[model samples]
Target: MNYSHTTLTGDEGPQQQVTMFLTRHTKTTANAIDLIQGWSDFPLTQEGIEIARQFGRGLQGTRFAAAYCGTLTRHYETARIALDNSGNDNVEIRFEPGLREYNFGSFEGRDVSTTHQAVAEWLGYSTVEEARAARGPKFDLDVQDALYALDAENMLHTDLVPQDRAESADMVKQRMWQAMTNIGDLVSREGGGNVLVISSGTAIRQFLWTIDSEVDLTYLGNTAVTKVDYDKGTFSIEQPVGSMAYYERGAQ
Candidate 1:
């Protein structure tokens, strides 16, 4: 919710504007196997395809000004599917490098159960379960949360030029915030309007966490939408995680 007050010629007065929709790319094959997928570029599962399509159908009547997608195939492909299904094929899907998922480095494509142990040890926790529990009772083998936990401490290897090491949580937020700021600048300079941002759940969760520590991210399901408004100077979460209810499909 970015805002600035300005006078109108008539009595209409100033109004707030600037809107963006953030959504997680649907499930991938890695998800089925309980593997951690960070920058691995796994293709979407069949279920993932349907999830994106349903979201698109739900958005069929809505029109977007433009779209921003990560360089990965799943990210861009999800955006494409939604845009096409939403009947907005004319909107350009820009390749946004900043929107890519966290670079998990050595942990990419590894089993979460195993990596949790490794990360826990790396972070000096007795066990990954202990570290996961430290975050809160609800947090499980969530790879995103685990990474954020490590990054919260000084354990992660950041400040590297090439960033071959695991990307810090702060870095992920910076990247997403940059993407939002760029879009916000575009909208502000060119007249504000709605924009679609296709990203991953882990990344989106980190962005939300960066903004508000009280945000509850436990039940955020596939293709869930988080509405945010932004200006060049600030980005605001209009709707927090799991704000949009998914289209119902039974017994899949």
Candidate 2:
């Protein structure tokens, strides 16, 4: 993909576009075991490291003006590996806490299946499968909503610390937007170019939802790239959301 955008500058000086290559972190041990990673820290699995390298190899010629990732092991490692393989290791990656995954609070590190079942019950569904059938693409968002509600009501895992309650969807959306806009504005001021960002699956999905509610929220595979363009104080999602084309290219 060319990964560039052009828009009229109008009275705001020269037109500058910052293309963001927003990617999800590679697979982690938690992911392999069907655990809810949330804010819980976990290192990337061997497969994940190779996937990140492949992602980098796919972008052999692309030069990044700026690089960033959440202040988490998985996020940082994926970004580091990708940049190194892509020949952009010289770029310093800035850590952004706002880019962190949605804090699952008490639910962090729990089994994914159990978590979904609890969320389903909270949502009035008899089972997770029933919820999935009814909610379709919105199932994931509903799960987040359930988590927020449960946390707010002090209903999740009584043994877990109260402070560990899940973050509301709105909160995640706000922080993500702030972080992304900050990065975009900063890059635009510095004469616009390609920007690389590594964030978690749920965080990326929620952020994209804030930009375009109709976006497919089904799934975001590890190391998948979602391209976005920031131009004229607005953000737009480019075609081929959650793309694996780059990874496929590199794997070949």
Candidate 3:
């Protein structure tokens, strides 16, 4: 596909635009079991592998100038499978720790219901359902804030778990923004072209939230692609967040 765009500047004539394909990693064992993965590393499920293959097949004709992924097994595994199936195996996948998911500290590997229950209490909601209804699109981000508060207070601390280990919403947003900006800068320096980036669900959402908080944050399915355009120094979402068209196309 022709992912490049050109814009006329007052005196600069035309400028090249770089396209960023930000994708969420496929389902993992933790996800399959309804666990809060956080910074934990989990292998992709068999179904996840197949879906990633479909994501690649859907973009069979597209070429990327660069590829990047978080320094997690799930992240790299998804990127590898998609690139291999898409015939872009030749592109080197760069690992960036800044792209990793939010650290949930003691909450890691816990049941989602359990975590949400605690978060609801921390946020002063009578129940998780109440919290969800009250916060609506911001509920997910509120969960992050509640987790950070719980961690900071040592509410769930054990000998192995330490206080203040979880990342606050601000921290996640800062790091994700920096990581994405750096990638954009690097690709733009290389003459601006299409780029592929694989990251976790929450991390990807946090990054997009930084760009536009009004974006829908209800859910982001596995292997869903969120297209963004980079030109000069600005980033803009190309479509609604978390479009599963690629996966659906590949399924056909």
* TM-score list, all predictions: 0.78, 0.91, 0.91
Q: How close is candidate 2 to the true structure, as a TM-score?
A: 0.91
Alpha-carbon local distance difference test for all models: 0.70, 0.86, 0.83
| Candidate 1 local lDDT, 86-173, one digit each (tens) | 8888997877777788887655687878777766676568886687667562343245545655544435455533355567667788
Query: Considering only N, C-alpha and C atoms within 3 Å, which residue pairs clash in candidate 3?
Result: none
Counted clashes in each candidate structure = 0, 1, 0
Model 1: lDDT equals 0.70
Model 2: which residue pairs collide? 105-164
**Model 1: CA > 4 A from native:** 1-16, 121-129, 137-162, 244-246, 249-252
Best by lDDT: 2
lDDT of 3: 0.83
TM-score of 3: 0.91
Which of the two candidates, 2 or 3, achieves a greater lDDT against the reference?
Answer: 2
Q: After superposition, how far is residue 174 of candidate 1 from its true place, in Å?
A: 1.6
Tell me each candidate's RMSD, in Å, in order.
7.0, 5.3, 5.7
Which portions of model 2 show Cα errors greater than 4 Å?
1-15, 157-163
